[model samples]
Target: MNTPLNLAALVLALSAALTSAPALAHGEAHAGAQAQEVVKEQKPWGIAGDADQVDRTIEVSMTDQMRFIPDRIEVKLGETIRFVHRNQGRVLHEFVLGTKQDLDEHAAMMVKFPGMEHDEPYMAHVGPGKREEIVWTFNRAGEFDFACLIAGHYQAGMVGKISVSPTN
Candidate 1:
């Protein structure tokens, strides 16, 4: 009788342990889920700068063959540029300014979102035959590439360079 009671007690304890193990594991996973929620809540809307205080103006034209007419733009550091970008192409085009690596990364991200576009602080876009404007200030002097993020556009030579020189 004593041995039977001991076995029954041990079996009950083992069953309880098995049941509680999953609950504890689930609790840990729930904490991880809450942490992820917090992280997502803290995510930022990546747009930068206000559109006031434009210093200089520029006119850029895009052609039907996916090309920028002036492949090189010259600017001075700390100068504000008001860009008039026009897309004369049959398809859509974007005038984006960034480093080569930035353009590559942006192009990769752009490929993932069909019909979704990202206009950076220093960039703008105008549909076919339409014109858009953007005013941005170049704080640093560097060689930045301007490219159209539409599919296969950059590869087809829809890219240009902006040379920002030091203010003398």
Candidate 2:
């Protein structure tokens, strides 16, 4: 094959590998370990919940400009909410729930491993014009955070806030 054709094949192979490597790398074993940790204690972010038990559903949009419409959200404590994520942009996006510190750390890791893929109850990875969902229970009464920790997406302002008001 000519040099140009060889380079083209290599580029295509690398692209495919980058896109699917994270899913193939993180499997059931990884989820099992995360689940075990979740049972140990609740993180500051929030906890995953059953979809059928959700108290309400919120529609969120991830746009090409790296922004989440309604960047700030309010929720009641102990309420389970279903997030309908729509990637109405031209690039890949994600909705990940975490605290400021948690998101910062995760974002840094994502920068290091651009191909990393993770499936968490507080997260939804959506392709352009695609939709995804996340069901979570805001059991704690504190402020939390969510972001699209995909490479430079978070830094590009694709972040949101969740205020969990204390219940009576």
Question: How do the predictions measure up, each by TM-score?
Answer: 0.66, 0.76
**Which one wins on TM-score?**
2
Off by over 4 Å in 2: 1-41
The per-prediction CA RMSD against the true structure, in angstroms, equals 15.1, 6.8
Candidate 2's TM-score = 0.76
lDDT (CA) per prediction: 0.66, 0.79
Relative to the unseen true structure, what is the C-alpha lDDT of residue 27 in candidate 2, on a scale of 0 to 100? 20
Residue 86, candidate 1: C-alpha displacement in angstroms: 1.4
TM-score quality measure for candidate 1: 0.66
**What lDDT tens digits, residue by residue, belong to model 2 across residues 29-147?**
22333334333236786688776799999999989888999899999999999999988988878888889998999999988987674556666777778787777888888889989
Cα-based lDDT at residue 120, candidate 1? 38
What global local distance difference test value does model 2 have?
Answer: 0.79
Clash counts for the predictions, in order: 0, 0
lDDT by residue (1-168, candidate 1, tens digit) is 699999999999999998875442211232223222212111121122234766677889998788897889998877778777877876666787778888788777666754553333445655667776655567767787888876677778889998889898
